[model samples]
Target chain A: MKLINILSEKKEIVLKKWFDKIAASYPVNAPSFLKNQKNQFANPVGYTIEETIEAVLDVLINEGTDKKAQEFLDRFVQVRAVQDFTPSRAVDFLFMLKQLMKDELKDELQEKGMYEEFLLMESRIDRMVLASFESYLKYREKIYELRVNEFKNMAFRLLERANLTFEFKDDDPAFEKDVSDSDNVK
Target chain B: MPNESKSDELKQDELVKIDYKPPKKDWMDTPVHFRHGTYIYPAKAKNLTYLGLPNPREWSPADEDWKLPDNWKDIILNGMKERLDKYRSFKVFMDICVRCGACADKCHFFIGGGDPKNMPVLRAELIRSVYKGNFTAAGKILGRLNGARGLTKDVIKEWFYYFYQCTECRRCSVFCPYGIDTAEITMMGRELLTLLGCNVNWVIEPVANCYRTGNHLGIQPHALKDMFEMLLDDIQDRTGVKIEPTFNRKGAEILFVTPSADYFADPGIYTCMGYLMLFHELGLDYTWSTYASEGGNFGLFTSHEMIKRLNAKIYAEAKRLGVKWIIGGECGHMWRVMHQYMDTMNGPADFLEEPVSPITGTRFENAKSTKMVHITEFTADLIKNNKLKLDPGRNDKLRITFHDSCNPARAMGILEEPRYIIKNVCNNFFEMPENTIREQTFCCAGGAGLGTDEMMEIRMRGGMPRANAVKHVHDKHGVNRLTCMCAIDRATLSTLMEYWVPDVKVTGIHELVANALVMKGEKERVVDIRGEALKEKKGEDNVR
Candidate 1:
């Protein structure tokens, strides 16, 4: 079988192992709750992890370098960004798939001599790790931006009342287009 | 050279360390790590001193030594002992938990952050363990085997970290079979921590502000008047109806109190404007107070005594102003205290008459004891009686959803009333999934004084369930406006939405109401209260 066929056939295998490995990052008793409580509203973190990781594997198994991978990974990263994990540790699980895939696909890979194709798919995950790293930093920056905006907004109307806040004076004609777009009907 | 190469390899190994393996130690034996985003800032000494709380000294969680009182352990024990004796509910909650793990994953913080410690069961165990270790014989004999531990500085540190992490939203209490109030456990944990001069400044400073400057942000009377004057200008400019609000005026028949943020903060100020416009349209005899300027009691987050001290002003101001009944504006915990604790903490309110909506003549039997009606209950009555003409089409440009602020939905059951008002005021109103609304509402995750900017990260994390549910409607129904009654929701959920679902805007329900209300002698409405351009102009919807 082609390496892609093997990957597609073994998709459920890969997702289960990946989900279990990621679920272990939570403390004792939590992994069970995450695995068992399948309701999205009740187990949002688990749901996000489950949903996003599948989307992530789909992007890899189908489109090796899908641009939407980062967006899929962004939902998962939003939970981890504010969590107790370091930036590298937060995205480290993405790299675990190589070992997972190798172990699960060893017989198929050795028989078909598909190590070269395996490396290509592995490199796609490497790029995804980088994408998630970028997402982590992006969310971290968004958090700081949120902090600044929270302070700014706590008194936003008060600032407007005091005339401390004002519209950007039109130095650029292009800004008018953005203004007009906002005026469009929702 | 060989040693330097080894160091480089070790550093690389540490950098690439995969954190998939759970720590081998038990949850209690595992060392605690207080990451930056999870913990709140310590209370300032001045605020503590102002409230005359014990051990008023400057301290930070980062320091090696927390500068605790010498007898901090004894103080906490005694405080716990006193509470266990005084509160039967606390005693029952302490002894009653079967640890069935029913509430284990119910917490938004636990669900989003994935920290087992944030679980309502475990978070309660942080204190319940101490109760076991110190008070129960089985715990003293069995120790760690009995799920109990001694009250040490590390235990205190964990308490401060975990308890403040709770918004005291009581979503957990909704699911517990025994109905253990984990939010009250957090409140008690916070109250005990206050005995050690350990509490967040975000809560304490507001308590002091309530004492010193008459509101949470310390906006003085004249400054509050100035802010209201700005709202008056916006009202006049938008609607061409000139209305003046009476502040601390006597004989107004009703005294209106709201979180100070309503007048001083964004989006909340628009809600404040809505109150003004609605009252002016009915010509209701209501007055705002510079004295009871704050309806939100940050003291509720501090201690019950602090709750009494801070909440005493409203009744005092009510008596002084000679108002008949109190009408609290859109706030979460404020109504929790009003409906649940106010009469007990402050009194029978014998001086004030039962709240009878002047326009609709509907007696608020629910508020007869406290003599304070929620603004939604009052306004829903107004809309019910057809006393106020509404133009729901003015809000046609936006799809809307109501977030039942945790306290109002769970504590007071003010669920349908707010929805009733929202439906009357806006044509497009969708409910979030059943699990995330009504009595099961998710918190804004910034309640109980955790709403400060420094606590932003966890607030966002803990707010995920709420944001996720909203994301459902936002994507499925194209709901862009998340209207809520709580002032904290207005302030914090905006940031939460920006992080999770940036398309959605957090709005106070009344902002929608004022936009739809057909005020008398008003000019052609051109803008909504936030000064946004309106889609359907006055009388344009009628023609359509």
Candidate 2:
């Protein structure tokens, strides 16, 4: 299948699992919480789920192993920073999901001896996302600094390039001597 | 017996002597309308404010401090003198006035207040006296001897108030054999007052603001874009018409124009939306420009130089945009400036092509020759040519009487265009008395810059005559709706209606047209995309 379709299917499964875990933990008003989705969900980021998923799939299209997949996940955090979504908000959302999973699936994970492995995966994802978010912030700050410096340089250059002239006084003795010399020459 | 008879004859002679004594009552003692009377002061006096001056008794030479630069003054004065000399029609009318009172009863103020001084001629004389005092040697010396006052700060203040009251309506001039225009005198007076920095704070402040910002209401470009987006959303909600109000669209076929006031202020924006929707329905290629957006020239309130400066951008923007014709909005002075002075100031624009109605293929003659057209005229022409589908029944209860704005009717002879459109769309259309109907109509008391709360009493007194005539029809024939072509007239008259005659409502002619025009089934009138209609609908629903 296409890389976009595979990514989209993965995103759907992950989102559903995340929501199910939350619902199982917070059972009292889980349905109401799920119904009141934000504008981002209603409008969606791209034309279709596949199109949005394609952006992530591009990083791992020709990957040999899980390293490239991990790298693609790390780049997701960078893309989020460029989109101006808060890194803290993303971290909070991830923590909420982890809490939900702990409450709902802890027993099952322990029985399967997969709890430590899942914890390690979560830690790796957290480090990758944080590093990428910091880089994006630095990039924006550097751009702002460059613009201010360029503007100051331009202003100074404009001042230097402006026309300048000197006015000589007619009453000066030197000016009188020059006039007299010119008249004699003529 | 002979002595008694002699005494009786002496008594009779005493009675005759008593009869000959000069009547004690001067007509001014119980003046019919105190508002219309000129509050005369000493000619040489400083600020003696009768008309809303803050410190009326104080005499300050602060006006002198605000004097124009020498070069600017020279240019302005020379340009004015040249224009005065060049405008042959105005000169002819000014020179030939015989002071006949045929137009005296034509004034709404005179009719309403029963003030003889409110007569258009006597009001014109107030300025004429000053003109004679300053311009001529005989007038300078003899004028003071004959009750003329030298132009002073107080006089300037008075000019600002009274001239603004005149509404530049040429209704009186229509009746005069000489066609003596009060609007010209009002314009001259406003120009002179502006030189003294005596402009109304409300008006001049906005004009200055317009100069600084793109629009008169000081709406910035980014804010305007946001507002348009909001309006577009509203349009979609109301009529399901998904259209964008094109901003700064360069190289459009037509420059879709309206007064900047409409975009910024109420009732105006509603009408603007209507225009936008109509244009959208027709699928016309047009764009709105922030640079040349303002149709109402406040410079027309002050000087010709100001008028020229304000109008300079219009033609330049049109040429830059490569548009064929500029379609002006429902503004009185805008149309007047466009119809009368735009070509004269800008000159024969050879670059623009003539405007043609896209649907009908009927060519608008002299569109390039003339730089602008009044929206009403354009719409009326289209309706007359049977280009638009209109249902008169939609305006079943609307009994509209058109009050021809002074500038368009008297100054530019634009009378029938609005009337034709009104009649076409509205079934219960009524014309006022023949004299008051077309060119001979009275001012709405507050025109020019005179529409102030302080001047309300005077405005009412002036509008009294017009109100009396309107009331006459209202009482007898059930004519409750007062429709006018001028935005200033709408502003002033609507205020008058709210206070003096609450029975009648004043609205723009376009508002009525927009109301009555046939729309597709369940498709709301696209005229007011600002969601004003939704509010009205909520109000109606509440009532129901």
Candidate 3:
């Protein structure tokens, strides 16, 4: 397969998971918040929903696109991982979007008598998309690890040719077992 | 008749000897005491060679194969003249100095030899006259009036000889109120001479060889390793101390350093042995890097870029070893390059931890943490802090006088450190007169790459002043031993002392200290009046 086709396929998988999470947190009363034609009335609920989706896209694209930006995000993620940030933070991001939209649209919804019904529908969709986004973030980490391992292998080969010695800890069980068996035979 | 024939045969042998003695009454007669005996005539001619004013008729045009361009002579003359003018300091010094002669007596050579040309002002005038004739309109118009002559083969020879005579000691500048540095003028003259392909074979050949190989001695890595191993064995045999001089060991706590010459030549290896023994005795963690082993920068004799290239290895090796500090062995220009120029050229070291003496717990105040240290200072501090158990009586009967090297004393202000170490180790110590010590000291005449046999006449003439001072004390106080800190000074002065005054001996200060070091269970390590080892074991087999 062409390299670009493979990259695009992987990017589509990542983007779909992100877009579904945003759609799930969409307000049921978003149309009401967008009303009052020719008036300067604040549409806080619609604005909140848009801003949250934009922030998530900014984070995802910053990590997934620009090479330097991705490296920086990887470094940040590694540091956060050391500090024990779990994969469940993706669910918390969805819940924050819902809370902001509810608070913003409550006054207008109350005037229309539709506040309780809209919140109930919005929350049910949030759970389904949050689960998918969490799994996508885990898959992104795996891809990063594979690329780093390939780079390290090339560096080791070059260093060997230069007559420099570098020994790493035996982390791969199969490779370690093979080396130990060869040593025993020798 | 047969006896008469035997007498005739004896007479023929006597006749062949031909009383080649001087005339009874001569015009060039020196005082009876001043007469130099058998070697005096050759020695006088040698002194005259240092004046560097050759006879013009000796010049011979080159053969066709190596013949210079027809206009090459003129081109060189004009180029040098223009360069002399462009140098602001040189121009200022040439035009400004009145014949006050305030700097006359200040030069160690002048005071020692009593030669007028050895005076700083007169020595500078030799080159300045050539400058004036070529550069100035007045000088060109009235050549005889300005004492400038046309550029000739004779002038080229004179430039080679006299310019090399100046050691670039910078002692004369101290007495100049206008602060005219004669050393700078000497450098310019030498540089111009080099451009005309006129360089002393001894200095230039070694420089070329060093460029090809990594060291002045032209010893490659294998030879260097072998020499170090040999010296290590010799050290163990001599001092009964086994020292493993580790090579290229990464993450060693310190880097044991020495001049590259030590890895190849004599007296240098002895000093290297001294360093190894001291390090071993202290039980310090250090390693030798073949890469950064050369401490002496020959480039300092020629150009700045060469200096940078030679010195680049030290810090690179320091980074490679992950060491805390670099400890340099006993060398002259090595310390000068490290103490003066290294940081400015290859610095801002981030990896180095600030040095606090392991024994004393006192920090070096003005020193860069990563830069360098003279081994004398390090060892002296150890002795001062009561870390090294030394017995002063070990050096008894070795009446010693110290000759300060120009670079270390004048350039680095390293006067007291070596002296302190020497005094602590030796029971009897003497310093030269105050004027001849420290910053005011004269060079051993073979400094600045002028240490060659072809230049021996000039070297001795230049060193006559220093030799005379040493003779004065030797005559008065019976002081026979001269201890110096610089390797060049030791090498040059040893040659000079052998030829000029054979009664005295010259040796490195570390050699004296190493000789005097009190080994475990040895009562003393002193040399008796006759220069015999007094602490020899009974029935010990003599190897040499």
- Model 1 Cα displacement at B541 (Å)? 5.9
Candidate 1 on B1-544: residue-level lDDT in tens?
Answer: 1254566656664655445676667677765676677678899998888878889887788777899989998899999999999999999999999999878878988888788889999999999999999999999999988988998898888898888999999989999999999989998999999999999999999999998888987887877888888899889988999999899899999999999889888778889999999999999998999889998999889998999998889999999989899999999999888888889988879999998987878999988889998998889888888888888888988899989999889998887888888888888999999999998888888988888888888898899999999999999999999999998899889889999999999889888889998988998888888778898766745421
Model 1 gets an lDDT of 0.87
Task: Give the winner by TM-score.
Answer: 1
Q: Write the per-residue lDDT of candidate 3 for residues B236-314, one digit (tens) a residue.
A: 5556566677888988888877776554443454566667667777777889877675777766664445567677778
Candidate number achieving the greatest lDDT relative to the actual structure = 1
In candidate 3, list every pair of residues with a backbone clash.
none
- The CAPRI-style docking tier of model 2 reads incorrect
Report every candidate's CA lDDT.
0.87, 0.56, 0.57
CA-only RMSD, every prediction:
4.2, 32.2, 38.4
Worst 10 residues of 3 chain A by lDDT: A36-45
Residue ranges of candidate 1 with Cα displaced over 4 Å: A155-186, B1-19, B540-544
- Which residue pairs does candidate 1 place in steric collision? none
Q: Lowest summed lDDT over 10 consecutive residues: which window, candidate 3 chain B?
A: B34-43
Docking class of 3: incorrect
Q: Report the error of model 1 at residue A15, Å.
A: 1.0
**Residue range with the least summed lDDT across 10 consecutive positions in model 1 chain B:** B1-10
Q: List the residue pairs that clash in candidate 2.
A: B108-B465, B108-B466, B109-B462, B111-B465, B112-B464, B112-B465, B274-B527
